[model samples]
Target: MSTGMPAYDESGDRSRRPTATNRTAAQVNTTALLDRLRTAGPQSLSALVQHTGLSTATVNRLVDRLIDEGLVLEAGRAAPTGGRPARLVGFNARARSVLALDIGSSKIAGAVTDLEARVVRRRRSAIVPGDDARPALYFFEALADLAASLVKDAATGPAPVRAVAVSVPGVVRRDTGRVEFAPSLQWYDLPLGALLEERLGLPVRVANDVNLLALAELRHGAARGRRDVLTIALGTGVGASLVLGGGLYAGSGGAAGEIGYTLLGRESLSTPWPGFGDLESRVGTAGMLARMRERTDALPDGFGPEDFLGLARSGDEAATAVLAEVVDDLSLTIGNAATLLNPELVVLGGGFGRAAADLLVPAVRRRLQGRIPLLPAITGAELEEAQLIGAAELAIDLAAAAPSPPT
Candidate 1:
């Protein structure tokens, strides 16, 4: 099961006789140094020492370890500051590869990416309605097959996949890496991460799709510079993810972003889906399409949410009316979230959200402007494949933190 390449240990050797508290401190400092270099670009040893507030010797030792692990690289020399020019080091973003998956309602998308989370190869497969009814063995087999194909097709030619990260439309238990609930996919308490790790022979991480979207925005998309941010995804369904004080907040049960279940009106005995809740039935893509169908029987054969938005933008009266109603419902829900969280930035993402952002943002803002005590900036996501990108980010992080192989 060895990867042929030497494993990396971001926290240095844990078997050393350093005190537990000192080891923890060193690990934290190492993470901070890597993050600093990754974000601020290359820096000289002295510069890193100054930024990290660590002693020169400590910084030098850490840098040497990182370089030996292939996570850090010497970029060049810095300008002399009255003495010898210091050599600069930077994150080696392409030194390793990660495999990421985005399991959606009707499709599963996989990609191979570098340490920078840039996709190098991608593949996808459709999921039929009855697929989930099959045994978990079959499901895992199919997933593992797809993952193997993706790895084999990596453009780098047989490079080891350092880690795997999967995104599911569900509440993922952070501690157990279990899908606690996934109404859309009918998954409950599934140990998906463990199964994947067993099959792939590598560390695996799982997260909620919406949460990953928020992470993508917070790290590399529109909400990059914001500390408190909210990402609302409107696709086949509706969900929200929160980032508070520059960190993703998954709440106690990993359900912090389950805003789609918020009640907007009286509860119904018959649900849209088996476990779908009130607000989702009203504001989700399915609801929007149903409403559009009710308004017009002459609808195009394959009309979808995107097509409806296009028609609305082109001044179709019926489409515009349908969009306005959905916008109202969404604005009300988002306004409630805004009032409670008071996020610095609200990023609208997902297929429907991104397509209808130009139309929805203005209306949502108008609805919130008068209701909330303080208004926050609202905008659309500026990144594509946000969930995939975020999954890659998680994979890179897990790979970077993994223990080094014995020499």
Candidate 2:
């Protein structure tokens, strides 16, 4: 997990001409300078040169470009000791903004954020289960409405909307940004990115919800400063994400960490339930509800996923038994992943995961102690809007990399 503050490498030859290579490298390195300002506030040009260890000429070139790009603005002067005051530069975070959305199975949530990926405004709409069964056009039209609403007020803000990034509950095609399959949403091969970009007249990035969540944890939450991690999301569904080499690893097909499909036993291998995977069927919300109904009928109907965890926390015998089973499944999954990826930490997130984290983290640690040779540090997510905020950060990156800033 990267905290998104990679070290500034001043290895470029100071005397190199501004060729295509130099321009490309400068564009990428410019972000490091801006990120520093984002975290450390304004600084003198001399200070930035000292901090980055780049030659004064190189820093001056980069700062001039950033000013032209509207990402940095002159912020008065710093006091000097008996010499001319140093010119200051600061990150202009509000000069540009992006929209982020998470279209989960249970609801749709979105936010508008500035360049630093801080949420300036947010909106969420609850979705009843099975609502996706409606016609795709109907569902999407409504979804687009909500997305538009998130940015409709952008005109009045300090920044202009530069781009939009969305996370969907599905396997997305890397090249096309198409939703290959989303069983929960009944969306298949949907050109979501292009459609939204066409509608909004802005750049759009679409990615897997879990992948975004993992990025969220890596950049803005509990897994910060870690280089490798496994973040599991236990909500209405069960899924996981991998952060390797301090970045997200979307496998060859953009489906690397689909742990929900893992088979726990030999019998599970023969089962052919494609909609919900084997591990997911056992540990997901439906699975817990099923186990509760099997063990005891004390709870009334219409009980939700969080209700089950809450009851278990209250020491209800049947709920506790079901929770123990969930913990066992999760421990097995985490132990196996740690053995392979050797992640430095493990993060538990999502609605159910967040709700049960206080109760689950300790039990999981005890369960994996002797089972796995190398145990990892376990923690809950620090951000409730991990997916949405992660998308904002990614959108900001995309905007910064564009040849020209948004009009």
Candidate 3:
């Protein structure tokens, strides 16, 4: 578990031992410098000092330290600056790799990404999650197998694997790394991060799928410019991720955006909703399809949510009516959320959500405009496999945060 960096040396100028506070500051400053180098590309010692706002002496020492750890490399000499060419140092994002997994109830999509979060290769496998009657061993073994296989495939030596990030369709405590529940997967109180770390010999970070998707969007998609945004996943189950003040806001219990559980209407105000919330129960994939089924028996067999949206788009009468109802439910839920949060943007995401976004966004916007005083601009999620991409980005951050490889 070397983190592909030299060992962290606490003893700087042994003559005067550094205090714990000083060591912490040094670590933070070093990370800041490395981040600057990673993002700004190659720079010479003097330029690094200017870019990082660190003293020339500090930048020189840190650069030399990173160079020793293989995290920094001499790209070449800089342009002649009235004197001898200065050596330019750059971050070596390829010095280490990461494994990012997007684990859905039916499938596990994995990829090996570089420290910069660029996908190197991808793989996926079908999954049948175990239930209460079944042991958890099967699920775990399958996951471990997928991680091992992904790492093996990418072990061609461009970079060494450093950490892992996983995306789960459930409630996960960000601080504890324990899964609270996954209705579809039937996984509860699962210590996914610890288990994976023990098995893979690397650090693991696990998060809810919707949150990760939001992270992906903010990092590399439509939420880029917005300071306050909501990323709602409209899939098998409804879930949302919140970004407030330019930061991923995981509430105290990591359930900040569980909007799916909101009460649907006055009729069910006191009714028991054990699993799927009223909003989700009414507007989720199953709910919309159920509406279609109730609409008519003349429709084609084996039709699904996607087909329902397609029919609605094509102006099928029954499907359009059903779509209207679905839109109403979604509009109510999204409008309420917008009224409360007043986010600058609302990003619709997930399989069903992304596909139906074209139809949903405008309708929701118009409804909210009349109902609420302020309305946020709504948009569909951009980027393929956004959850996985978010996982990759998290894995990269985990790797990057590792104590600058032990110089």
TM-score of each: 0.89, 0.87, 0.87
- The model with the greater lDDT, 2 or 3, is 3
Better of 1 and 2 by TM-score: 1
Tens digit per residue, CA lDDT, model 1, 217-277: 7778898777788899998888998887767787877789888787775554354545666
lDDT of 3 by residue, 1-407 (tens): 12322111111111122222354556555666666676678878887676556778777886787777778898999989799999988898888889999988778899998877788888898877546356455666788899988887776766767788899988887765688887677788888888888888778888888888988887678887566888999888999988877677778777777878888778878888888888888888888888877888766788888788888889999888987887888888878888788899999999988998899998887777768878889999997899998888777766765754443
lDDT of every model, 2 decimals = 0.77, 0.77, 0.78
> Residues 1-407, candidate 2, lDDT per residue (tens digit)?
11121211111111111223353666556765765687678988777777666678878998888888788899998877899988889988877888888887657888888888888888888766454456555556767888888778885777767778888888986556788888777788889888887788777878888778877776668877777788888877888888776667778888877888888888987789778888888888888898999998566868888678778879989999988998898888889899988999999998778778998899999999988888999998888778887788767766654545445
Pick by lDDT: which candidate is best? 3
Give the best candidate by TM-score. Answer: 1
After superposition, which runs of candidate 1 have C-alpha atoms over 4 Å from their true positions?
A: 1-22, 129-138, 152-159, 266-274
Cα displacement (angstroms), candidate 1, residue 371, comes to: 2.5
Model 3 residue runs over 4 Å out of place are 1-23, 43-53, 75-88, 129-132, 403-407
Global local distance difference test of model 2: 0.77
Candidate 2, 67: how far from true, in Å? 1.9
